[model samples]
Target: MTSPTTRSRTAAACMAVLLAGLAIGAAPAALAGTEDDAGLEQTVEAGEEVVTEDAVVTDGHVDVGPRFLDDEWTMLARDDREVPSVWRDPARTVLHLGDAAVLPAPDGPDYEFLGVEPGTPLHVVPQTQTPDVVWLGWNTQDPRVVDSVEQGATLRLDGLDGPGELFVFLQEGVTGPPNVLWDSGEPLPQELWMEVNTHVHANWVFTEPGIYRLDVTTLADLADGTQAEDESTLVFAVGQDTDPAQALAAVAADTTSDTASDTADEQTADGAASSDASPAADPATEVTDAPEAGAPSSDSGGSAMLVWGAALAAVVLLLVVVGRVLRARRARDAADQATGDAS
Candidate 1:
């Protein structure tokens, strides 16, 4: 048999050899260059393009896999930088917010837009512009912030020789929560679909006819021509048959009329509850009629009923407990009276 010291030395040698083998196996990964990697970049020269980088840019046509449902005030921008242009309508109208229709395109190399800096708090808020309009657009993507188009950038359309504005946003990434404001100054709506290195144009028309200012501002270190106000700010001339101020005044008047109607309704409700006179034969004739008999309740009565039922049950239980206490008191008093009579 081998001596204990000899066995120990052999065991130590084996351990050293195993460790050396592991180090040699891991060395290549640590020192490898991009060339050693499999399947590298596939740059396109405007021919039939395949889906590279999870993007569906086949046949020079970027297939935006799923179409985003639009809202009245849709968002268009990269991280912290909102597209300088947006739909002026409370509903989605393609005319106002489209950069290509107004601003001219640049003649230089294509510039990409970036959204969402790494480790930033990104959120989006979706709000309604009109009664029926919903805002929607691309947001942060898997690679977080990447490149796209620039908002407020000047552009030239094919037919219109003069230049106009160009607003751009990401193509695809995420579609919920923490919308990015293009810059730190103006905050756009919240709800937006996230896109990584993609570009999109928000299309819309002005609902109310008016000459609205096409506002553009940015703080990005983009190409010099697109920069404005330390960032960039541009205003386009919007000519409508109606004046913006006049249209706004009309909207205000309608709002006031609604407020007065609401006040009248409150007064009528109070009168009906406390007055001795019978209410008008039909409340429908006196005011806006309630929804149809089969229609869903406007007051959310289903949820209200559940709450009231729970409250009523609690009150009934309290009353029953009180009644039990009273009966117990009566029995105690009778017992005391019988004891006194016995005395």
Candidate 2:
């Protein structure tokens, strides 16, 4: 026979072993569940990526382009936690730092890095000597449509502001208001854009395929520490040609359709909301549907004419009674006078 203490110890050892096995067996499941939960949370967050809607200005003079691809992009005022808003058409396209990005410039392809903002002297260009490092935070920026480029097709780049010299400086060579083709090194008018200024609108068409470096620089008046000085360079790129123009057009069309759809949706939503908001009618209360637009309503005019005719009849009867009373009095007075004269 085993001693009581020994038996108790044995039982305790077995329980401990069982518990340890259970813990080891459950560990993977618990960890996997945790990972799944975390993944679900990530999916939810990613799915909720907030794309800003079209910004409409009451002033009527607001930039109109996919906020991401807009050459007339504006920098967010410093001190705001929200990153400066940028928009792109091809929503699926990804942008990388030092990758072809557009910026404010004085001449050539310019990037508007900063405008009138507090603390940063109004219109002053921040020093960015390193052209490659100057980047717009496009970590979340994706084109509205993805993979919309085709081989051998050209894209038109219209710059906001004015007609001035436009240059596309690549790591390979320099192409400007006079565009140089990447393949044969020959130039085409399709690639060339007229020189424009800050107020003039200019457009350029790029028809060659392959990865190309984009460097745009332009000068703007900046009151720098007392004297006006500084030029800003804007850089961006066009990637492997895969029907970029068509894709851009498609994206634009999609955006337009989306806008119209949104408007329709909003109208629908408004109508629904208005209908829903209407006060519930009491079962005892009656509703009369109004007539259609521009059509005469239910012979109301005829009813009014009938009422006017009745009023006119009453007036004519009153007038006839007064005239008869006056005539009777006049005839009686004349006979009485003649009788007195005869007596």
Candidate 3:
């Protein structure tokens, strides 16, 4: 018969082996994937592997193109945990386009903010000398269960602050911005978006690290014949030096500053973002959707570079947590056995 200690050792060895196998299996998907090579005019054969790092941002701008291809979910649903106070709804509604809520999904993509807590902080995955990528998973929460969502709900991402074009994905959607219905007749151009119930995944690229905010607005027509529009402020911290609150305060100060030139420049940037055209002349803006040349561009490759990274990070974190739990349980079991043996 195997000694109890021997059995424990065997179990631990098996656990380590399990962890190794998981790592090996996941390494490729996590680290390698394809993106659109619009600038290169090269086609990534179906199932081609690529990396987002290849889409380098020179001069802190998104001028480079043959836009990257991505058909992946940056985060997925993980196991459930209780909500922390900071993450609970802030009682605000009416979100504009481009506004993103900063929530962590260090595990898998989140479902209704199910996998993360307020303090589940995130750093750029795959630690690098020049870390410009952030993988984020978020979900818009609607307490009102749709008895019947009459018109397909749409989420519009409109305004943006800071550099780099923002790309969001609906797990199964395309790599670029998700599909949207646009109308120039609106006060500002409009993008029709799929209404999100609990989770959305995205790859956030910041040509330069800083605080960024995208005004989010969601509108949906319900079965009750009432049109619902909710808007909220979503804050993001890009890199170690960013503070969302501080950025907001700075913008406020700049508003009342004597620097009229700075304000005009700001307006120009905002104007460019509101249009379908990209601020950069690079081919990245040459997407097929929206208005003609110089029109705002949106495309979806639905590739998997950032999706794998986020998934890998979540797996690693989950493994670590599981390992700790197993070790603690084994330690407790051994102690109990020792006491029983002594008795």
Candidate 4:
């Protein structure tokens, strides 16, 4: 017959084995959670500072967006071209458009809205990142901005001055349709609504290469039952040959130019009345469609898949361990019963 001492020792051994198996199974899931928390903390800490120095960013990631500095609304560029991204004064930053930015315009009726001949060269800063070309986007993710703003803000393209037309558009997914945000061919002061804490990237297409200046404005309702508004000029040198100094010195474009152009077109029309007409209303301003805010970053989906995969693997291992433990217990029980009967 099995002694009480032997049975107690076997029970202890089984408990140890089960505990070790559980620890092994749970390790991966615990590690994944720790990593996710660290990533989120890093993002928040990275945006806590605003760098006041002038910078020229030709490559890597950068965001042109709005922020609150000392309770005042301001437009700035969040430069991530290097480690520890910081907010920069828009007037002091130059976004260089290099030769790597050039691409042949895609052939499709949908792209014709770009007002470019299909297959012609277009300088594009894509929504998705390219290694050598600068990845430019906008965000309202500054901690200060998020705390001050109510729900969101309105981004207005007040004016644009450039050698070629500019177009901004967003694609839903890899194969989704394009949603145009701002078109230089359209009227001035076009607005786009942006939810607070949103980080968004869009394709910036330039029809030709040269210096371009965009007059950008942000307006928002503050949490304190007040309104805040600010405007700044965003300058770009849109070619290797274009001088960054020229863009820095560029002034805000005359917002009245669009109205002037329309008036001139009316005068040249045959049999058209010479009466003075107001500039065409911007249809975009009335509807103000907001882009997909807080879209998952490229790595977010992959990270989620990895976490789920690890959890699944752990569960499978645990089930296998539990099954083995049950079978071993059953065998021990039968052996002990047979020995007792023999005794």
Q: Which candidate is the best by TM-score?
A: 4
TM-score order of candidates, top first = 4, 3, 2, 1
lDDT of 3 by residue, 1-343 (tens): 4433544444334322212222111122223233421111111122222222111111111100011124211111111111210122211111111212222322212321222232333232111111233222333232232233454455455666654334332222212122223222234434544433322332332333565555556555667786665553344455544554565464455446736878888999999878857465658667544567764334322345667788999999999999999999999999999999999
Off by over 4 Å in 3: 1-135, 138-143, 170-192, 195-198, 248-343
**Candidate 4: count of backbone clashes, pairs at least 3 residues apart or interchain:** 0
Score each candidate by Cα lDDT: 0.29, 0.29, 0.36, 0.71
Task: Summarize candidate 2's per-residue lDDT along 1-343 as a digit string, tens digits.
Answer: 4433544444334322212222111122124234322211110011112343322111111111111123332211011112443332223222222222222222122212212111211111011111332212111111211112111111223221111232332111111122122211223222321111101111111222222222222122222222111111122123223333443344446558979999999999999999999998787886767988987777887898999999999999999999999999999999999999999
Candidate 1 local lDDT, 268-336, one digit each (tens):
999887776655566556665688878878577888898999999999999999999999999999999
User: Candidate 2, which segments miss by more than 4 Å at Cα?
Assistant: 1-151, 159-166, 169-303
Superposition error at 336 for model 2 (Å): 1.8
Positional deviation of residue 336's Cα in model 1 after best superposition, in angstroms: 99
TM-score list, all predictions? 0.20, 0.29, 0.32, 0.60
Off by over 4 Å in 4: 1-42, 251-343
